[model samples]
Target: MSDANNQTKAAPKHSAMHIAVGLLARRDYSRQQIQLKLQQKQYDADEIETTLDHCQQSGYLDDARFAALLLKSHISKGHGVNKIRQSMQQKGLSRALIEQVLLDSECDWFEVAKLKAQKKYGEAVPLDHPTRAKCIRYLMGQGFDYEQANYALAVEVD
Candidate 1:
């Protein structure tokens, strides 16, 4: 019948709040990330805004908390501040939030670079020019600045 066919073709309707909550149940999401997801689901702008407000009001969504957790996770994985900032930006976190979380973090980037270098290369600093350059490039790729990369290459690993 046409009625049965129409019913089958119709997508199951879910409120924006319900969809957002379902997503949050799986993992933490930034407000912007949630907005993008809702937009992708074809939610109206007003409905998306209301859902976002409610989620924030209920403490189910907190950008600050998400930023902190993201920073901590990146640091634990031996990522540098630059890499962490890039990741946060890609995740739609605001610059101010990213800076605040990074500022609040107690990670010693120098030490992290050193450890990462040590873990990858070994206790000894690279001596040959080409090998040293390679090591510096590797550290830089991992988001360490030139100074930090040089320090990682020059310092004696203990």
Candidate 2:
């Protein structure tokens, strides 16, 4: 009797499909995030895999689409290529997919850097070489290429 009870306790308490649906209903998650969360919940690996496959087939989960959403939100908030790439990679996106998205984006990355720097500097920009250099550094830290950073810093946004 105790053995049978123990076996029942070890079994999954929730259906795989229910967990998948609950997660997706919250927000878009990368496959990796979904998998990690599912694993944490002690879902059966095979059952989870089957659920993931079904979710993909039914369009409940999509890495490519998740990548696009990440790109758009990051761009809107002024994230640079490297930052966005790293963010997506942490969520299990492939480098090739990241590169393709950046390449296809029409957003002016240089302009983005400049705008971001200008906002951070407020009004003491052109007169302050040190501040300008600091801005350059900050923008670089955001993953802008040197050329892009230079152009962004050189031109004052009026």
Candidate 3:
């Protein structure tokens, strides 16, 4: 009976800091993502806020670092600027932060688009309207702008 009672009482509640640290140890999270996760874990609102503040002050929770890592990962995966921007926004990053990260990035979207297109569709422009449109759609889906996608399709096959 006592065992059953203890089990029913719920697991001991972890401190917000401990929970936040555990989450951080697994992967980087934006402040908003951390806050949302803490909320989902049923931490007290005030405690969650305080813990997040402490994490930020202690340099354990850096949105800039998180954003930079995400941006680099997306770029490496052949994502275009607009797609990366949209993804960052979805992760609750501020427009200013997204813009700042992009502004600081030295990657050339055009070149990336060209390489990605070549890799996927071969190093030649589509020979037909249907094929060209398909190629364009694929690049657009990958976050390349119209001009970049078109420019990539225009590159000669080696």
Say which candidate scores most in lDDT.
Answer: 3
lDDT score of residue 99 within candidate 2: 86
lDDT of 3 by residue, 93-137 (tens): 999999999999988999999989988987566779998999999
Residues 1-158, candidate 2: write the lDDT tens digits: 99999998895678878988899988998777888888898888998898899888989999888999999999887778888888999999888888888888888998888777668765445547786677778888887878877877674557
**On a 0 to 100 scale, what is the lDDT of residue 146 in model 2?**
80
Per-residue lDDT for 1-158 in model 1, tens only? 99999999999989999999999988899999999999999999999999999999999999998998898788778888888999999999999989989888978899999989999998888799999999988888888888888888785546
Q: Which residue runs does candidate 3 get wrong by more than 4 Å?
A: 2-4, 7-9
TM-score of each model, in listed order: 0.93, 0.85, 0.92
Error of 3 at 43 (Å): 1.4
**Top candidate when judged by TM-score against the true structure:** 1
Clashes of 3: 0
| Regions of candidate 1 where Cα sits further than 4 Å from its true position | 8-11
Model 2 CA lDDT for position 98 = 80
